[model samples]
Target: MKKDKNRYTVFEHEALYVHRGEQKLSDAQLKAFQLFYKERDFPYYSLVHNGIRFCEYVGVIKVGNLTIEVLPKADKSNGEEHWRSILIDMMRSTGLFHPDSPSYSSLKVKNSTILDMYLELFATEVERLMHQGLIKKYRKTQSNSTALKGKLLIGKQVTLNAVHQEHFYIEHTVYDKEHLLHQILSKALTTVVKIGTASHLISRYKRVLLDFPEQRDIKVNESLFDKIKYDRKSQSYQTAVDIAKIILLNFHPDLSQGSSHVLALMFDMNALWEKFVLRSLQRNAPDGLEVSGQVSKDFWTPETGYTKKIRPDIVIRKNNEAVAVLDTKWKNIGDANPSDDDLRQLYAYSRYHNNVPSYLVYPGNENKSLSGMYSRAFVGDAQTPGGVIKLKVHSGKRDGMELLNQNISAILF
Candidate 1:
């Protein structure tokens, strides 16, 4: 547990200042950040005069030896550790990273960063895989062999063996560990070795690499992971491969600058929050009720172009009929009203879904449900619609998911 002076921790929607002689950022590091910001469509942080202001995205950002961890916050009194744990829980709930919980003793020492958690999980999986034995696949290879093999190439044999009479050119299939899955895992292990700052995990990483077989490294990217298809033989590697994708895809190294790189493992809080609520509702919904998120329907279609779709965040149905529409917001609108855009969006959902009830859900101190209705002028109808538009908020001191279930039950059930 050595002290890392280069690490900085901040909450979401907070700023990490980097003025001259103010923050420890060097000129090269600043340029690296600038280039990273310009090259990618990263929406997690916005550039400020002194430094970067993190938005509603929470995770770790490593620039060379420097580590910046942005954590989620619901209340100002909550510290970084609280939000870090909550973030991990949310990710687990959404089936993102499947790591076992880190011990409480480690939290007290204040040594492990988010990146360390990822490396630990990845190394642990690799260890398990090594003990079980790495899977091998048959790959095609071509070369000049002393004896004839599977397929003899007449043209190559005549051209190359003309010089050496004892040689034979052939193409053959060899069953071994050199395959796509091994290549991906090997690349991820090397990535951990390169940028890892946690002292304890370095030895674990090296140990895993020692037993792992050599693999031909390919340029890892998002598409490479998408191209993978798992079968009965490779099903055991699903969890390890999922974790590997998170590690390799989020990593971006600055090649032009010396030893300066940027690795961001941030998740959009808005998207994560929406997904959390959707999962909770899906799991707890009663027998007859159906819960679906991002239910899209065609909104408009041109004569020649593609049709536009309108999706509601959450749609609730009972007995095969659309009953309610819910739009979850991560921001707290305590004692205040939701924005006009939010109301309008819900209104559109209600109108399109046969005027079923709509509600805007937010995070707050308690479930202070507000009820209202669309007026005649607003609805553009002869009489006002009976379907009510409401505001719902949920808060919990012990378990947020339980409170969320109670609030949703009270509203729809």
Candidate 2:
């Protein structure tokens, strides 16, 4: 990184005194003075006389005298502009700025854009803080009244009465600064990984597809298929499948009999998770593999005002056939296995995609035994298909890319 000379006072002094000002001094003397100044503040008279020469040597500000420098102290407004510029640069460095055409100009910096960039950088933390109820809003009001009578007015010219009232309120939420800062840092990290992984997958797929277009086809004869399936030409397909599986595993909701609360949380997480997954697939999937997110299809239903609209998280297609339908849920899956709701949703996805095999993925517990639950549920039962399979995602302990690799391997192979 280039040093920001303007940031330091010594450089500023040197620029002002030696370069911009008419201060005259021998090179050796100037060097000696600078060295002395580094140890302690320059005496007022020496600075006054030599400040110009000193600044010229340093190459920052032009110094006129001890009391005055050509470079004035940054005023509040100028300082604000400088801070804003720094923030814009930060945004550009963080990939928030457009590479092709710069969004920031030399003149005015967009306040809204700056704010949005800050929010994006700190959304996760902000959201977490909000969830903890660390921020709150309230309101207040006031009123007054009086009374009157017709008899009073008549009596005396009588008695009389009157009334008056007033009301007002103000409201806003206060945020915990410490908690907000912590959350922002945490979320920023998570956003980077999520974004980076997606980008990598997309780039990888684009390269493979460009290299081998033939591998994009979904339907292939058994003999030729096995030969090219694991070859370099098929790398894009493999990557797409892998990325999709990982997304499904991390984002899928857990389903159990009559558990509305867990299901709701699962749905919320799935919304974000699926979006990331779709973006990744789009970035990396070969042209042959048609990857789409939240695809909506409508069919007439029993109700007059309602139509059956199906939106699948991911639909991976090869040729005309919908090869796979993947739905992500954030719910934790237990040993008890797939519930009726789980089966029903997958079945719906399959039906919507013309009987395609649908996968429902959820997070799995690390130290728990799922075998016992499976055995109990399958006692004396033959291998009955058309049910959801439970996949455990140990995202908390493992690398995201590695976890995704495992998911893709399971999905494709």
Candidate 3:
């Protein structure tokens, strides 16, 4: 089966080798090759497997002597449903089973294996397609037939009485009387002083001024008390003021301000970084893959009583397998590597979820190596290769997302 200089390997009754070189494949040569290898598992198999008419007429692949054709399988009676069931069953048997296995019971036994095998292959192709940015992949929703329904409210607005009740009426009055000396003085003071200062003065004098005459101030004993004047109240007030000043001065405003800013910025950066990570996950996941963002899991211990809850940034599921868990850390996870707290958290997630692999994704620092931790203890170093992964979000010259995609693809596929 030699047509050209390039050798095409065929896995058939015999492993036939063909040289397809300078000469282009003839129609008859392609048709013969397709018919011979139509049902076989190879790169060109998809052309024929898609349909018989497709192989014969649209010839996606060149076969020996005969061009491949694809024809749509007949959808009479329950043929389509039967085939779908068969595919599901086969997939289940081959370790790619959906958790909801009963859904495939209606599918035909004969078509199940073939369809399932094709689905497995399709999954791989879908992964490749997603990586190449040639196609968009979405996870199939569990409930395909469900539709959201909007409720319509048909009603009229009810009118209420506009009259205010005697008790309900709130009187907000502003009286301007330049002729009233006390009122004028109060207004002038309010206008001149800051709101805080005015409020303070009003509060201080509120108890003393029960009546207009009670506001009178008596003259101090000047000459008689001048010699033996003991200023007790003034001395106490001065001492209290000195103590208050010392307390205010002791307050470390800079430390508090710096911490507040750092926390705010960390959250802002984390939010942006998380979005990028989610996009990368969505882009790389295969069709029928479900991704959950910020999934929380709560664990309770006998000693601690619901010790803590962990929220992984991303949790990806394929064929109902809790495949990967990713945590995004915005902090500079220095070249020295993740702190003990980080390792404990990730390891707890893994241990809690039956040893699911966990990844700690951080901003790329050229100095750090993607390493693993080995201990459950939060303090000291324990072991090597504890199944923890430190994925650096690569630095400089290359696109971060591209690097992320590459790393994810390698890990997932």
Q: Top lDDT: which candidate number?
A: 1
| Candidate number with the higher TM-score (1 or 3) | 1
Which residue segments of model 1 deviate by more than 4 Å? 1-3, 20-24, 99-113, 380-403
lDDT measured at residue 314 in model 3 versus the true structure, 0 to 100: 78
Give the per-residue lDDT of model 2 (tens digit) for 1-413.
Answer: 12223222321223334443443344543444454445434332235444432321111111111111122111223333333343344234333343222222321333322322322323322333334443221222212223331112233221221221221122223232332222223333332233332232334334332332121112212232234234343232332222222222222111222111110001122443455445545555666788777778885586567787888788888996787777766555555666778666766776767666566655444322221112224322432234333433322233342454355444433
Taking all chains together, each candidate's TM-score versus the true structure is 0.89, 0.32, 0.31
Model 1 has an lDDT value of 0.76
TM-score preference between candidates 2 and 3, better one:
2
**lDDT values, one for every candidate:** 0.76, 0.37, 0.38
lDDT of 3: 0.38
Distance (Å) between predicted and true CA of 211, model 3?
Answer: 58
Better of 1 and 2 by lDDT: 1
Tell me the lDDT of candidate 2.
Answer: 0.37
Quick one: best TM-score, which candidate? 1
